[model samples]
Target: MRMAAGTEDRERGADLAEAAPIIRANGLSVYYGTKQVLSDVTLDFPSNKVTAIIGPSGCGKSTLLRCFNRMNDLIPNFNMTGQILFDGVDLYGPGVDSTEIRYQVGMVFQRPNPFPKSIFDNVAFGPKINGYEGKLDELVEQSLRRAALWEEVKDRLKSSALALSGGQQQRLCIARALAVHPRVILMDEPCSALDPFATLAIEELMRELSEDYSIIIVTHNMQQAARASDYTAFLMGNEERIGELIEFGETRQITTNPEDERTEAYITGRFG
Candidate 1:
């Protein structure tokens, strides 16, 4: 039976409120040199769930996602203020190793970006770099299975990743991220580059993965956010081009009964 939207929202809210957050942001802000992109954004990403960040273009959705693993550090002159805590540790604290943080919080790009190596090699790369002492072949198979791509590519593990279809390659990328056993996975519009069937495949994979890994995705697709995520954060930019979190809550409420009128307007196609 289909539940009423309010009933679903209330149930989900109660459940999520009790779950411990795997990552918490406090007064988070991002800047590229002199330009501020994200301003005073704060939110909690609960463990073993999918949190989707949705906003119009230039709203810094991707910027906030990169802050999780400190990917923004790679960009020159990029800086931030405030705390991004992972498992109670400040990500930007002194002596923190960005490399280790990245291993714990892996990222999947918008496009499928598998290396020019074979399918087996693509999945094995991370485990190899992180110095996995166990059997390499087993880890590769396990990662592929977790990404829901093992059956299709088991026979062609040696084939070049480029030889696979677009969806297969994206799954291969996901399998690569899983090989490292990351606690949290951040995806930036993971389905934006795929066909409808491929997009659905990724969404299904996300649902299954949430059982073991906390997933955070930045997406512009409203319907996708409504369908795939457990929680939704709506962000909007001000006149000065600084993005801020306007509303955040269970996906059902955020989509059906957003507390902020701006969020409702954007979701209803009135404006972005």
Candidate 2:
């Protein structure tokens, strides 16, 4: 039998509190050039769970997700203050390697961006570049299988990844990320460009993936967040008009009984 939602949330919270957070943001503020994009946001992401970051457009949801892997460092004028910790290690600390961090924390973009290479090659690329000494074929097959794309593409492993349908290409990209054995997967509007059927497929895949990897997704779709995530974080512009986290809690709570008026407003369609 299923437990009541409140009981489930409390039990889940108790269990999570006993474990260390897989990722944490402490007073994180981000800026480009002179304009601050995010302001003093702090939160923790539990391991092996799906956490959705939701907000209206231009609210720094993507910026916060990118910070986990130091992706913002690539921008010319990007700067941030405060700490992002992964497995308790400061991601931006001295002696930490951003390249290795990215390997552990993979990203899937808004649209399918499969390489021009064949499907087999795309899945094997990361492992090969990392000097994987295991059976390459088995590794590729395992990754594809985990992504739920192996059976569909198994017969045509040598076919060009670009030739696959849009949904298949996105799954192939997921397979590529899994090949690296990443601990966390960050998806930035991963379903924005897909059809309804394809979107459903991805949502299902995410639930399955959370059993093994931490999944943090930035989405503008409230329905998607309510349906797919275990936890939700609502971010919006503060009085200063820079993105700041308004409320965060179990998905049920955030969607149904948000603590902040702003969060309620955004979720209830009163205003973005």
Candidate 3:
């Protein structure tokens, strides 16, 4: 009993709810002063999986990513009202500690930003601040290994972080985040600044990391999302254009066939 080639995508997508979603959002919205960027958006991120947020430029994808770890709070005039629940705990609740939230949910930005210190210091910074009492050398080694940069930088542990290439520096950043022992990792266009080989390496690292950590990435490259992500969420450009969640579902389904016309258009080269 084979389905037709062009059947309804919504029908196929509805069949993918077997797993429970770990992070849930309800009626999420964001505003920058008088400007309303995101509208009401609700979605779920399944545990231990990679969820990619893909859309045209200015989509609420990055903005939504910030909400997970409260990165938005750093922006002046950034205000949002929503429920971002992590393991059933509302991250924005009155008692929720922003510092703890960041420790549990780490972030990696687009560019490779490393401190002007030794490579070891860059990885150990978070743990030292968190009062990690374990063996510092072991922790530094493990975090670097997890980032897949250990094999490349083991001999130069004491070398300046800036001595490494662009790609290595980015991995060091990832290790720094890992040193804090986060449960979820939020990546904002992590590979945009890397070369083709480096991008592939990062994608592979992401897949590997998902075995133990949940990952949410905001990326413009639809192909990367299709290739690396387990779930996909599509967002539209923001207001002035009013960014909003367009559609979300399984990665294969979203790329090969999407529920919304806009998602299909963006994936099929019809539009970004």
Ranking by lDDT: 1, 2, 3
Q: What TM-score does model 3 achieve against the real structure?
A: 0.93
Backbone atom clashes (below 3 Å) for every candidate: 0, 0, 4
lDDT of 1 by residue, 1-272 (tens): 11112233545656666878899888898999999999988787899999999999999999999999999999999999989999889999999999999999999999999999999999999889888999999999999999999999999999999999999999999999999999999999999899999999999999999999999999989999998999998889998989988877889888889877889999998997
Judge candidate 2 at residue 76 and give its lDDT: 85
Indicate the worst ten consecutive residues by lDDT in candidate 2: 1-10
Give per-residue CA lDDT, model 3, range 1-272, as digits (tens): 11112332456435544445667777788988888888877777888899999888877788899999988899989988778898889999998999999999999999989999999999999999889999999999999999999999999899999999888998999999999999999999999999988998999999999998999999988889988999888888744687877787779888777867878988888986
Where in model 1 is the C-alpha error above 4 Å? 1-14
Tens digits of lDDT, candidate 2, 60-119: 999999999989999989999998889999999999999899999999999999989999
Compute the lDDT for candidate 1: 0.91
lDDT of model number 3: 0.86
**Whole-structure CA lDDT of model 2:** 0.89
> Number of the top candidate by lDDT?
1
TM-score of each: 0.95, 0.94, 0.93
Task: Give Cα distance to truth, residue 24, candidate 1, Å.
Answer: 0.6
